[model samples]
Target: MELYAKVLNYTMPVFLLLILVEQLAARRMGKQVNRSLDSVSSISSGMTNVIKDVLGLTISLLTYDWLVGHVAIFKINATWLTYAVTILVIDFKGYWVHRWEHRVNILWNRHVIHHSSEEFNLSCALRQTVSTVFDYFAFLLLPAAVLGVPVEVMAVVAPIHLFLQFWYHTRLIGKMGVLEKIIVTPSHHRVHHAINPIYMDRNFGQLLILWDKWFGTFQEELEEEPCVYGITRPARTWNPLKINFQHFWLLLRDAYHARSWKDKLRIWFMPTGWRPEDVKQRYPVYTIADLQAYAKYDPPGSSGFSIWAWTQLLVCYGLLIYLFAHLVTIGFSHAAVYGGFLVLSIYAFTELMDRNPHAWAFELVKATVGLGIIYWLGDWFGASQQYPWLTPLVGAYQVLSFFVSAYFSAAIRAGQPLPEAESVHQHGA
Candidate 1:
């Protein structure tokens, strides 16, 4: 976990820098690929995912270490040949895991957060899920274990494999000539994220395009059929926590209310977006039937609200970075408390961005809990000991945040429209 945190500390800044570059490139080209609220929500979702990972919040039904110990037919030496084979095996496992997540009903809930955004950009790639509490794909790596691949090799390559996918999640890049046929590129990934009927569930490869081509799921990007990014059923809220579990909650309700015992038992394993007939008929859920007629999930937000959202995000991010840097010293118990606070802070601010009717009250509760924690601990995980002035500065910032939240609440109460609700383009592709 400490090693993962160190790696994230370096890679996160590069990801943010590239996102800024994408935004600038979009501006120069007169296209808007990043919306302020959407981008904030995306980054917040990423922070939650990282916190979950750093805190070791997952249950593995089967252990890879156990598999490696028991399943090896021959031990392979660590060399260039071994590294090449490891990459290929990992990518093969990745392809199956990716495919299963899209094909299964319960599993899709774990991946829906990644596809929730209407805009496909670098920030959107960071919108990972926080609700995946179980690691069910351990069996997928049995082939690697059988090949006598070392766990150390996997530890080194897993993060690199995940990080490499980030560079392809942009609209600024087009198809590469030969690479398009061999590897996953920006164009292939764009098709994967699109909700267009022809492109849905296509291109499930991670590092290589060979798996998708062999499995008959590959689809080429066509100029006439531009991709429309987002899920068929929109997640209409800016709160990442809510978006993470929204589908699971629906499944739970459907299972409970299903008429037949078979329907109740099978609802979970059914295809993605399937519901019991009784549940579907009695309690209807909204879905996009006409792609051209739907609007993206953009709520109204004034400049004051935008500034308030950005400030809160930065504050939360700073707290996250501090916690991550000191995770070894802070220990898991205190880190969990700090992680909970950060989650609440993100939830409160994003609700305000969404203009929720009860947002101010949530903010008040969040601020009060924050102050109580500071007073109880007497400092921010021992920052006062090093910096001397850090605690007081944080206290002042907390008070200021409450006032800023209240001010926006009052402004929203008045009969005024949000300052910047209009889109750069009147319609989407």
Candidate 2:
């Protein structure tokens, strides 16, 4: 089999597994796992935007390179130490960037989109700005690129970091107990995503918890006080364009309205939702006190089975992701990962558009697009070069994915209320 085909062999399994897991998580959380899936979709959109920006920047960088020969700051003599150092340094940079995004208004405007989620799950990690290449690329890649780090090495580093961080977005895993004392556990990150004032600005590390601990920003999850996920001000908007740019636009408006340059500077540099001269008043205060006011849900009488089924699905998805990793390391190029992501993006976007029964056609369109993406990635990754017979292997998976998505979409539309917080109570359903 070609490398793509080999990858597809594994990739298909991972996709199936993720879908299963998502279903399980949804059931466990007593909501449609769409929130989690939406997170993935949002992140995928941000990634796509980032890629487009990177391509443009690459062109500009190349143009500038003509004026000056390519130069690098680091040597290509990579060692274990180099890799370790690279990971640590990248992590630290991310920490600061993430922290700054929360602190500075302009940046926070972009970063807060992630925090706008009213629910916490694996997909929240995907909530980010695609145009943030300008803000993040240099800090992350420039140092390594200057040192002459191989692009291949750089590529692998990002995915590994992402893979490590991916599990942190979930509510499925509880605190790691002792490990939570040192590592960035899902429980720890939950605090970071909480709209609770005390939890805000805590636990910012992507892979390492040390940054938060070292910086005194670490806060343990409280057993008695449940974390209420999302920002004080929920976005409430569904327009992707608005969701992406709303904060930035708000910042610009505030900046323009300031009477003095100092006030304007403060507005831009200060934390998002901060208004000049307002000491105690903060915007979008989504405290536990606030959320408790909403009416509670009692899961449908059949939810025990739903939760169990969803759990099984999660296990399957996990297996699929693992298989994908193996396939990538074996013979597949980066395209396999990209292909898997394409399907993930499609799956996620489906959740986003699923709010309306009238959008059923959009669901079909997304599924078809996902199938096509799977086909392209399978062929592009070297399936045709190895075993042509294996081409149909991925093709089959794509077909299955499409049909499965359509089935789920129809099911969801047929009065199957998507998962919500109230749905997950132990006493319910």
Candidate 3:
């Protein structure tokens, strides 16, 4: 875990830089692919995912080591060929797992966050999942296990493979000439992220496009059928926590009120977007039935609110970088506590950004928690020990955060219409 955190300390900045570059590049090309608030939400979602991963919040039902040991049919020598084969096996596993997540009901819960953003930009790619607490991706690694790939090799290669998928998530680049046929490019992934009928549930490749081509799920980007990003059932808020579990909550609601026992039992495993017939008719969720007239969720917000949201995003990111840098020195307990605080900090500011009427209350809770952490630890996990001013600065920020949140909360209370401000489609004023 420490190693992973350290690795991210290097890679994460690169990811940030690429996001900026993508923004600039798109603007240069006269395209508006990213909105400031949407980008903040996307990056905040990334931070949550990073914190969860660094804390090792997930557990596989079967360990890769155990799988390889029990199922190895032939022992392959540890050479370049071994690593090459490992990538292929892992990519194959990724293709099937991704396909299932888009096809099955329960599995989509872990993937919806990735597709929640209405805009298709590099930052939206960062909208990853923190909801996949007990994952079963290892079960899909049967071919790797059968090939007797070393566990160390898989560990080294898996993260690289995941990182490789990041660059292709941008919209700045169009179709790559020959490479389009061989690898997953921006065009292919745009299709994957699109909600248009032709683009829905296609292009499930990780590093290779061949899998999609072979599996008959490939769809080329057509100029006529322009891509409309986001899920059909829109994630209505700026809260990543809510978006992460919205589908699962829907499934839970449907299963409980489903009337028929068989319908309740099968709701979970049924095809993605399938709800009980009775439940669907009675409590219909708002889905965009017509792509022609659909609009992106964009609420009004003051310039002050946008700046504040960006500030919170930056501070939260800095806090995460600090936690990662000091993961070992701080120890697990401190890291966990700090991680929890970061989660609250994110939830507080983001809900406030959403312009929730009760968001100020969450902001108050977050401030109290921040102050409590400072008091309980006598420092911020050893930050005060190095930089004496950090503790007070962090404490001040918490207080300042609450006040800023209250100001916006007041605007929301005043029945302020958001038309004069920027967008995020919430109660934002």
TM-score of 3: 0.95
lDDT of 3 by residue, 1-429 (tens): 999999999999999999999888888999998888999999999999999999999988888999999999988877999999889988999999999999999999999999999999889889999999897878788888898988999999999998998988877788999999999999999999999998999999999999999989999999889899999999988899999999999999999999999999999999999998899999989999998798888778766578778988999998898999999999998898999999998898889778888889998999999999889989888987788988888998888888767877877888785333344323332
Q: What is the C-alpha RMSD of each candidate to the true structure, in Å?
A: 4.2, 9.0, 3.1
Off by over 4 Å in 2: 1-16, 25-76, 136-152, 277-289, 294-429
Please report, in order, the local distance difference test score of every candidate based on alpha carbons: 0.87, 0.56, 0.90
Model 1 ranges off by over 4 Å: 418-429
lDDT of 2 by residue, 328-428 (tens): 44343453454444434333433334343433454456456545654556552444666575446545544544443444345466877554434434323
What's the lDDT for residue 101 in model 2?
A: 84
Error of 2 at 428 (Å): 35
Q: Residue 23 CA error for candidate 3 (Å)?
A: 1.1
How far residue 197's Cα lies from its native spot in candidate 1, in Å, is 0.5
All candidates' TM-scores?
0.95, 0.59, 0.95
Error of 2 at 364 (Å): 16
Q: How far is 385's C-alpha from truth in model 1 (Å)?
A: 2.1
Pairs that collide in candidate 3 are 298-425, 299-424, 299-425
